[model samples]
Target: MFYTTIFVIVPPFFLWRKKMKTEHLLEFVNVSMAFDDRQLFQNFNLTVDSNEVVGLTGQSGSGKSTLLRIAVDLVTPQSGEVYALDRPVKDWDPRELRRNVILVLQESQMFPNTVRDNLTWGLKIHGESIDDEALLKILEEVQLSSLDLDDDAFNLSGGEKQRIAIARAMMMNPKALLLDEPTAALDTESAIAVEEVLDELIKTHQIGILIVTHNVEQARRFTSRVVDIHAGSG
Candidate 1:
């Protein structure tokens, strides 16, 4: 009887350890990156669970944006690994990975189309047409309630354009949002609007957010946790 109990308990314990070892929302151990001769980060490590917002801040040349790109698999690190959703980022299909972990950038580029079309572009590309109410709800979530449905996206202001870009990204309902300097070029009002929208999206959708910014004060307003990076020192 003693031997039987011992066999069962030990096997289960070992199996549980194995499963935990392979399970993580996102993880990077001893990650490093370089561009030409300049080192971006060395032995940098990060781990984030689902639905958590992570704020990253650093100096202009400290590679904060580059780190965001690396997290989403857009930029490969010279050495080290990136994992998303418990799998190596490189092992996942690019399209699938993108759908799962979407990146929102600072630059805004809109196709010459109606605001509706631009906002619903992601759904259309994914072989699904937008549900009118759903699209409108997303637009509203980003506080683009004033965006006329029939208006051309290209005619919008820079802040409007950025909001539209965010709407497009949200159309996929991704698990993680990796934002790279999203509010850098916007005015104070617009920047506040974007931050508010981001906060709402994360809370309502339960999506993890990682924002890379140079403004420490701005980061403090939105995220509960902040990671400050220094080049070559991780």
Candidate 2:
């Protein structure tokens, strides 16, 4: 008689816990936001470790993207505090803070220039220099190794543009990435490609990701922990 052995696979959370660093890359304490009479978040608190993927989900106006913006200091809460790298968001230099906690929006904008130009634009502004070999390595990570540097950014599809934007942010070696609907604009194929890249990034680089996605299925697949603004309030 032959016996069958079945293996049970562990969830991503267990693996993530093993790899996570002690310190949180970002944190929100008693956060509250309102637009005039409308209240978005009240007494909201969350923390993102240095090596974890957190998914944010909610309805259309539930402050998912707004939360990410708060991390990067793009939007200030009416009350409460946000911290990055253990320092208060308001205390850090805006340019320096953005370098460490970069935000990549859904509709990523690309300069009407060569792909290489767009990739290096941030570095140029920050006065950082990298060789072609280093540059090409990052391109390969984003699955754009085959594209010519001279290729026009405007010619690429929406997915390609998003990937380029992500690659640009990666060049800064951020501690945490704030993604607002990263794959929302992509087709199935493109979305899958980007997802694969994100998986590798988390596994290899141990970069923390706070992603705001409306697709619950995608959130389940991508994140170890999911936070719903509405649910959390109750």
Candidate 3:
């Protein structure tokens, strides 16, 4: 009888450890979506492993960005389920969920204040206590050291603004990041800079990322897995 119990318990522990060691960080089970009765998707499944970069690609209006919104819980699906960090999204509190799952929209909004305020906004909203040193580190990571803390974000370049947006998402130490056309407005240099920072973050912090972009090269450059969305199940 003791041997039987031991065998059963040991296998379960080993399985748990195996799961923990792997990334399988985010999952979607038969996800579907619709807007105003227009069907966007049906029975779609996707999984993102930790430190894995996934690219979401499709033609214009193919619901690529909408898919990320659903994953981040900014929008609800008509059917199916989304789980982040292995927990049902609905089971987690909304405020706490926002902290864990950060999303950068196609057009990021900057507060009418200093660069410091914009970077710290999400952290403060999530009740995270961070010091100046930590803030500086994150800003430097995203190559925004040139922007003074007191300087108005209103005047920053498009690339600088986007980098700041990325920094805000990173400050939360999130399990995953949802990026929608993060570099759409940047020059070549700035776009490369943003991509480099993202690559560094993936290697150093093991943060899982789902980026929405129409640029096939960007998708090829960053993502380990590619999810292609086509028109009407094509």
Question: Stretches of candidate 2 above 4 Å error?
Answer: 1-22
Better of 1 and 3 by TM-score: 3
What's the ranking of the predictions by TM-score, best on top?
A: 2, 3, 1
Per-residue lDDT tens digits for candidate 2, residues 1-234, read 123222233456666666454457988888888888999878888888766888888889988888888888989999998899877999999999999999999989998699888888888889988777777888899999988888999999998898899888998888899999989988878887888888887777788998988887787777889888766531
**Candidate 1 overall Cα lDDT vs. reference?**
0.81
Regions of model 1 farther than 4 Å from truth: 1-24, 231-234
Maximum-TM-score candidate: 2
The model with the greater TM-score, 2 or 3, is 2
Error at 8, model 2, angstroms: 54
List all candidate RMSDs to the true structure. 3.7, 11.7, 3.0
Task: Report the Cα lDDT for candidate 3.
Answer: 0.80
Quote the positional error of residue 69 for candidate 1 in Å: 1.8
What's the C-alpha lDDT at position 225 in model 1? 80
Query: Candidate 3's residue-wise lDDT over 40-131, tens digit each?
Result: 77777778877888887777776778888787688898888889887778888887787888889866889979888988898777676778
TM-score on alpha carbons, each prediction: 0.86, 0.87, 0.87
Residue-level lDDT for 68 in candidate 1: 75
- Whose lDDT is higher: candidate 1's or candidate 2's? 2
Candidate 1 C-alpha lDDT tens digits along 1-234: 999999989998998888777665667767887899998778777776666777777777878878777877889988888898878899999888898888888877897689988877777777888667887898899998877788988888888888888888888988888888888899888888888888888788888888787776787787768877753221
The Cα local distance difference test for each model comes to 0.81, 0.84, 0.80
The per-residue C-alpha lDDT of model 3 at residue 76 equals 90
